[model samples]
Target: MSTNLTSETAAPTRVALVTGGSGGIGRAVVERLARDGFALGVHYSGNKAKADETVAAIVAGGGRAIAIGGDVAEERDMSAAFDAVEAEFGGIDVVVNTAGIMILSPIATMDLDELDRMLRTNVRGTFVVSQQAARRVRSGGAIVNFSTSVTRTQFPSYGGYVASKAAVESMTLILARELRGKDVTVNAVAPGPTATPLFLTGKDDVAIAGLAQAVPLQRLGQPTDIAETVAFLAGSARWINGQVIFTNGGLA
Candidate 1:
């Protein structure tokens, strides 16, 4: 089962498919992986304009990229995304599942519909994407899924969100173990209070400042900060598998 394709013996360029690549952290990951010499398939659910912008930026920088559209929670959509990337790049090497949504509410008072949406997008979405990655990614590749530091912080009003991410963490560990000696590493990155639109929207300056000060670093995380960790896991951090790397600036 050991089909490890190290750089020394494999093709010159690796290929990566990043879900939610039109968004904040996903865009950063797409750019970082492109710069890391990966041919990229940037997948977005909605907003082709944004996805195109991300791809354009990469091509402008002389990096290879393509924009693919699909709903991550849908198996057919995600499967097609993988197929497109494989068709273009000849093979898939890395898969980064960054497509997720957060709707905060106390479990006691939460809207069941919202909870279901979060579960479908965050939990089921990761499951569907990971299934494709496990089946298609070449040896020596890695799968990086997005979780959240809130899973550890256990904050109030985050019950639904935390539950979804907890499922992600569990699935990530199980997938890594299932891969066995396939030479593919599976892991999750849980970031805290990143300064993405998803985090900043609807929050006042005071709330944002409070979140920033809560971190030991005294500032919210930037997309690039999380991208660096993703790049490590997607590229060279082969020994680091089946674990959640918390990039929360000591917030947890």
Candidate 2:
């Protein structure tokens, strides 16, 4: 048997729904899972074009994929997204939530509006999606949520962002325990300074370089690097549950 796993190598019946799948780490996870032979639901918030393009590429690669659009914080939107995926692919076996925002601001001086926006999408979004997943995902399924290494790094100006992700971590842990006897493993991947647009948008070259050097591995992480962990948790690593896996390159 060939070592390479592509859409052709495994059963296409197992399905995955990825939130924020249009770009950044979400895109990488979609591509990786397609290679692993899972028919995918690519969930986008606002940019349907990017989601459509992602679906087109996967389909072009002989993989099964579709784009789903929704506001992760809205129950109706997320419920509809889940319904669409289940309708198209039969059932959902794995859900990877990589949708998040990083707005840097000091806790003391942060605007209430900015804090509300961050909490709405990050905290409430995870809750809404997880609620749907908990009720809808089939047996032997897994749930992987995104977190940040900053929760441990305690970086300045990340109070709001970290606070939001901290909520994600709490939920991931409790959900794992809550899903007992259901054969669903829930976990969170906490990444450090990945090179996605989310991390690079406002930083200068110097700021970026310094962050890369801080990692003991001496380089910034790629979206693929984080996706690799997600795919593992989704497909294998059955015993790893109710914990935070720091996907950072030894950057503690």
Clashing residue pairs in candidate 2 are none
What root-mean-square deviation over C-alphas does model 2 reach?
3.2
C-alpha lDDT values of all predictions: 0.94, 0.94
For model 2, where is the 10-residue window of minimal lDDT? 4-13
Worst 10 residues of 1 by lDDT: 5-14
lDDT of 2 at 127: 94
Model 1 residue 61 lDDT? 91
lDDT of 2 by residue, 151-210 (tens): 999999999999999999999999999999999999999999999999999899999999
Model 1 lDDT per residue over 1-252, tens place: 779997788866899999999889999999999888999999999899999999999999999999999999999999899999989889999999999998878889999999999999999999999999999999899999999999888988889999999999999999999999899999999999999998988789998999999999999999999999999999779899999999999996
Error of 2 at 193 (Å): 0.5
Q: For candidate 2, what is the TM-score?
A: 0.95
TM-score for each prediction? 0.95, 0.95
List candidate 1 stretches off by more than 4 Å.
1-11
